[model samples]
Target: MPIGILTTDTGKLVEIRETITLNSDAFSNSFHEDLQFHFNNERIPERVVHAKGGGAFGYFEVTHDVSKFTKADVLNGVGKKTEVFVRFSSATEQLGGNDAARDIKGLSVKFYTKEGNWDLLCLSTPVFFFKDPIHFPSFFHAMKRNPKTNLIDFSMRWDFVTKQPESLNGFLYLLSDYGIPNGYRKMDAFAIHTFEINNKHGDKYFVRFNFRTEQGEEALTSAEARAQDPDYYNKDLYNAIEKKNYPIWKLEMDVMTLNDIKRVDYDPFDVTRLWKKGTYTTVPIGCLVLNKNPDNFFRTVELSAGNPGNLVPGIPGPLDNLFRSRRMMYRQTQVHRLKVNHNRIRINEPLYWKVYNRDGRPPVRENMKDAPNYYPNSYNGPVPYIDPARPKERFTIYERNAVDLEPAAYFYNHYLCDEGQRQRLVNNTAQSLVPVSPYLQQRALRLLSLTDPQLGIRVAECLEEALETPTPAPHAIKIPRHPYEGNKHYVHL
Candidate 1:
């Protein structure tokens, strides 16, 4: 067989000598086209959050019969397997940031089910930083770099944490050893929002999804994580898959009936708080096994989009304000970044879909061919399927203005049971707080004290010990004093 000639993006053959310019003219179309093509579209917009991630192809097999709880085909029959693509990411890290950094890990699984694509966007922790979606921007902004200095400022982080006391429970988890997981394979994932699922009888149940790692939970200490490779998590996942040591997670659900929701003392839909233990029964639904690695990172991983709004029958989208906001925000962000036809992308496309949405972006494919794009048409446009099992009742949620500290208090006292775990939490919290300003540190300490006095005391003692040793500043850049520091005639400017 003979080798084919190199061609431009337009498929025009190129001459051997056309690759270089003639004399000093540099007017070759082939050379310019190649250079322009490479230069013009070499990069795509980075994700605003969860920019750094690794993805793998897998299958979720239903190991237990969950048909009694819901009518979802994905969780119905035992031994049923559904193709899945799982992406693990760092919530706050940029594209090239360290995977082992002490940050929230994002675990989103796109299940290519028989009906359509169902995305379960999850986080490493069972609780989130804040409840209301209004604080979403501020929470992420504080977690990210400072605007002026363009650095991770501890004062900025602590300031937000102190002001929003509801964030204490989340911060407690983040400041614990669990914050730095050994790798993505060893960590659990939780759908923090409480979703409502219905049975064939239209019986509704409020449930929380948890994917517990079958590999057993493991974590890296602050020192151990700092010494590992920056892409340790990605490398670990890829290598494990390549070696055929597939990682697996058992899918479980904590279910509460409508009556149980009314009997609960705390808000069931609160993302910042966890349901009290024993209040709901945990049911093992299935197991997810990652058996294959993505062939191309950019195509299979980078371009993949997961939204909480993607749901099949049985499971209805959560009505929580944060979840509702995310349902709109995720799709819009993907549209702005990956275009409106992002779902048309190979990795994100559903196993079966027939929507009336047509045209607007490049990968519109057939654009639903000649079918009508509008509903209620005589030409037989795609119509919504009404599931008889779907719940129709509307429930009222009472709004509360009070700040609850019991969750954090429960986490600190009950969850962090052992002395070693408690000490590690104190050390981790102190390590981050040491760089914060004195006032902000005091405020943080006050917040922690409200959760548990011993937690506050231990952290303060660690800070005191750290201050006694007086380490050098993180950066050596010195600011120039103002020219009119002591001048009485200086203007207000």
Candidate 2:
């Protein structure tokens, strides 16, 4: 029996089988039952974060030459196009939660460059909750509901920010209308992390990706978002593609030079801050248009794997602690949940294929028998290596003291230069943390004082004066999710 497909000039490409018709396959519950029963015995682990989502197919076309800034080929070719798939989801919500709800949506993009895959794991907002990756678990604990009670606790979120005063920049964006996006297509996506690009000459500059939506920026009011359908984002994407109003965004980048990094008051590698490290701001790079929707949601949208480790030539990795943590965590989680063949799924293996990484469960054998399974085997095996003429790798980071990632190795003080910035940080803290226990609140304020005095005093005065702070708007209710909350569901097959 042969698989059937509708090809050019053929009415229908069908294989005539003596025992069964293709139509009969529709009633094949037993086949499904056997697999699903096995699946039930197993489990589908939810992403510890970014639980629910929708994705689409598109191409990211280079619209400008950024060769002077970075060696990334995708940024060099003015008219070059790289295939892309983007998935949007609320970071804290479960799979069936409201899409337009007040929450940070994970804006993840995968660029299938000629060299390899490049994954940008970003939040809709440019800044994040915390800068130092060492405080990662603390940030999650703050966002999540109290362990004792399943309900949300503002005290948790406030506690963490209160301790980490530097988080004000990111928290302000969240409290503002920018927190809730109307839909995936209406939001400005980001390559939030600071990356470095090396040219063939071995010169390097910091890089950040900015994706401005062509449909225009839009956000729903908290009330409006709450009342909308749970699948609002998913519906908007699907319907737009159906109507041919294909969504698009231009890929822009802020390339900061080495001198730029030295001058900025903030560390560009800090995921928690968003400031131009260089004299030059975002340079026009390319445009990405999502024109095709997924054929199967589970295989593509839900199971898609993304990691910063997949980079092509000209594009080099930044030694950010968060990025390094993700490389190990993401690769481990994907293997643990979806198996080693997750990339072999049609949704992920659109054009690029790695031949040597064969002989796994769910293997599609994309290249067939001609391709060797082992590299440098007796037969002609896959011997692809780093292109020497492309971007050369940058400075190597010694891992001797980077293992525990001690606080001394991470914390920075340059972002506290401004009195207004300090005041705003303190004021925001005092206002947000007043409701918590006085002991904890005072402890937090004391910690803020460690970083900056004005910060500590203002927060104390603000909290003292906030005797009757008004209740947050009904829709202002927030529930944060931890990094590990959704991972328990995954069971190894």
Candidate 3:
């Protein structure tokens, strides 16, 4: 490589790069352009969710071969390793918000493999707030701040949640002790949706990934979290790595055959519910270790973006509505936030790649010189791989419909075995719902009653007590607007 000292954006030699002195007429063109270029593009849009995040550089090492499950080259054999970048975030919080806040955690990983980049997008909780993509905006608006007051409103939050009974399970999980994890290293992660994977024999299977932290799971109560430092998680991670203590997570997966899904009682692909834990076996895939801290936070951590669409050859496109909707939304937001060539950014870019995509804003590399831009040309170009091992997806025809609170109720009544845990769930639910109106409170009680009778009765009693002596809060004094009221902009108000 030639030794060249130049500006990062334009690759021009450094000449007259300094600003003009007070007595001079004007600054050099390079100086002015570099300043303007940097000033104009200093920041990109933060993620609508997962706004606050920290990341590290590491490698994912294959511990057990999964060749029978998928033909993805990264997981083909034991001892195989690939470079990875993992970003951990707290969803529903601003960039400056506290890390130990009681919220869902985002676990996004990018594997730079021999074939291409593969992103494993996941969350700390196994289930989500709702199943349908249409409820996405409503759910976030409810969880987020009230527009007029710029404060969290329990009335708005409980109203939408109570109406969508499917969200009750996830809501209960968030209100539990597991909600406020001690730190990123102590939390478990799950791929919240079903993914399609194929083997070299063209055999396909529905799969869900689970990453349990080897550090052992730990969490803090609401009072404990409030007493600790806000950025405790971020600082703990950085300090752990600096002290040569790397955090690790083992990758386990649940595999279901085509016939297995048919026999299951619930929808296997529902994001709001999980596959019964004992019904399927969890195969050990690999282990991920985060060992290096980022040198530049903005360059590596802030600009990094991952999507469900960035899949390898072995893992074909997902067919679930939630997965499909996320692919489209991720692309739209990435393009809007970081331009069409967002992947070309340093941390997100693939280690080795070739493509016909060229000539866009921030064209950093050689624009495939003297090569035909279109396909079917005489010159060599990237061609589509019609793989011999491509699996034929099994299609089912049926009217997709939503169910009531049966699944959420089942989990609460059966899965939660501890008496103390049950009591905590009831207390958390009551404390949060106490500020809302009686109508919404009763609605929540009805939904919870369907799940577990005692849960509903207990919450009802708490509400009755709370109603006799209501808490003094600003939001409780007035009626709340519609959940989507603040979404639209007023041009001539």
Question: Candidate 1, clashing residue pairs?
Answer: none
lDDT of 3 by residue, 1-493 (tens): 9566655356765555345444554444666667777899887787888899899999999999889889999988899989999999998888888998889998999999988899998888888887678888889888878989988888887888778777877888888877888999999999887888899999888889889999998988888998988789899888999998999999988999877877887777788887886567779999999999999999888889898789999888567776778889999998888888888888888988777878887634677776778876777887776899986657652425675576677666776678877777777788898778878878888878878788899888876776688556665566789988989876995
Model 2 agreement with the true structure over 378-453: per-residue lDDT tens digits: 8776566665645444554332221111121122234344455444444545555766887777776666566456
Q: What does candidate 1 score on TM?
A: 0.93
Under the 3 Å rule for N, CA and C atoms, how many clashes does model 1 have?
0
Model 2's lDDT to the true fold?
A: 0.70
Candidate 2: deviation at residue 407, Å? 19
The 0-to-1 C-alpha lDDT of every candidate, in the order given, reads 0.90, 0.70, 0.83
Task: Tell me which residue pairs clash in candidate 2.
Answer: 45-490, 143-480, 251-286
TM-score of predicted structure 3: 0.87
Q: Which stretches of candidate 3 lie over 4 Å from their true place?
A: 1-41, 393-399, 464-493
Candidate 1, residue 204: how far the Cα is off, in Å = 0.6
Provide the TM-score for each candidate, comma-separated. Answer: 0.93, 0.74, 0.87
Prediction 1 global C-alpha lDDT? 0.90
TM-score attained by model 2: 0.74
